[model samples]
Target: MSKNLEHQFSMLVREVRKEFVGNGPKEISTRFVGNWAISEMKGNLTNVEKFMISSEQGKQMVHEARTKMVKQIYKKAEVVNKFEALMGAKVLRMFSDINIDEDIAMTVFVFEQSIESKGK
Candidate 1:
């Protein structure tokens, strides 16, 4: 993704974290993945597959959740503008193979992204 999009995604993650403070990074990771309807697709999903391809409605719900999360970060922007800013962009893509300790993975990725961007 472009740096601008990556920055925005990072900001979204930060805003999500801020809203869930004291619940800690594990809670943030849970929230981030909360709306995914991948379980429905798991009937066909293989152990090697990281993501589940879902129905249109499932995808729509996921989109809406992402939008809601982004809006929490950039509330002053118009809806269209916020959607444009947040859509299809990520600073760091979460792994398809979830680690045994996924929360640790998420916290590390978030901190790494922030640290890497500091001097840029």
Candidate 2:
């Protein structure tokens, strides 16, 4: 990106970081690889897909993925921090610090609504 864009993105990321930090760590659920599959698994995938592609069951996937993810997260602080910063910004922009999950869901709903409304 251009210097100006990078600066703006950095500022936005900083704002997000502040909100996220202010809310604290335990309350704010961040993904450390394991968290991703833990929070995102559908529990309804086909056996074929799970076995052939994933090479393991959902639980095993969570364990292995989490281990790998945690390692990557620890090794690459800069990239992880940037991702966290973006996530924080997005969460902050969409919801109050008090009710993060609900706010995030509502934000998505609202964005979808806006897109649909615009399409109409």
Candidate 3:
């Protein structure tokens, strides 16, 4: 597990963040374990977006919007190619979720095979 692998994962996250949010988060951190990479996003929302996601209903709405965005983005083969290139592993699945209370989002990327040692 090279730290560079974590950095590559973080870069992939920031790139994807840009697609959905028009810009990357203030910070993106990633950890690799087994066949999974977990990305933590900070400053994931603007002031107005924060207000809109303040309540339970707002949170649900935002969650659904994020889900839709994920689906749409996954349709781009270039995006998938970039992911595989950066990860050095075939992506099996991806999951994204946001916590309005924390103003943070976490995305999990599961690979068909382990990337833990591939980047080393």
Candidate 4:
């Protein structure tokens, strides 16, 4: 995919996350590979979340909540449809995880077809 296309996709993802998560990552980068779009995000934790992660139990809870919240948001038809339209392919599944210690997150979107080829 062209760099411009990738940037646009990243921006869209950031905006969607901000809308749902209340705060978006400070930075996001995306790469298209085969039928997948992989996004790496940095500075995803809020100040309160950062404080909460000081304790072992708080760390686990924050990790669980952050990861599960992302998955739950993707379950909404509007969210899935937005991604499908952006990729010009049906979204098969979405997987996401967050690292509380690093304040980083990774989100992978699987498309039914080769979105990388389509972009080119």
For each candidate in the order shown, give its overall lDDT on alpha carbons: 0.32, 0.29, 0.79, 0.90
Give candidates' CA RMSD values in order.
Answer: 13.5, 15.1, 1.9, 1.0
Show where candidate 2 strays beyond 4 Å: 1-49, 52-62, 87-120
Runs in model 1 deviating more than 4 A are 23-85, 88-104, 107-120
Top model number, TM-score: 4
Q: What would the per-residue lDDT of candidate 4 be over residues 22-110, giving only the tens digit for each residue?
A: 99999999999999999999999988998999999999999999999999999999988888887789999999998788888999999
For candidate 2, lDDT tens digit of each residue in 13-113? 33443443232122222122211201111122224323533443544554444334334333445644553453332111122111211222110101111
Error of 2 at 92 (Å): 18
TM-score of 3: 0.85
| lDDT tens digits, residue span 16-47, model 3 | 77876687789888888889988888887766
Residue-level lDDT of model 1, residues 9-43, one tens digit each, is 44554454445431212222221222221111012
Query: Clashing residue pairs in candidate 3, if any?
Result: none
Flag regions of model 3 displaced more than 4 Å: none
What lDDT score goes with residue 15 in model 4? 90
Select the stronger candidate by lDDT from 1 and 4.
4
Tell me how candidate 1 scores on lDDT.
0.32
Root mean square deviation (Cα) for candidate 1: 13.5
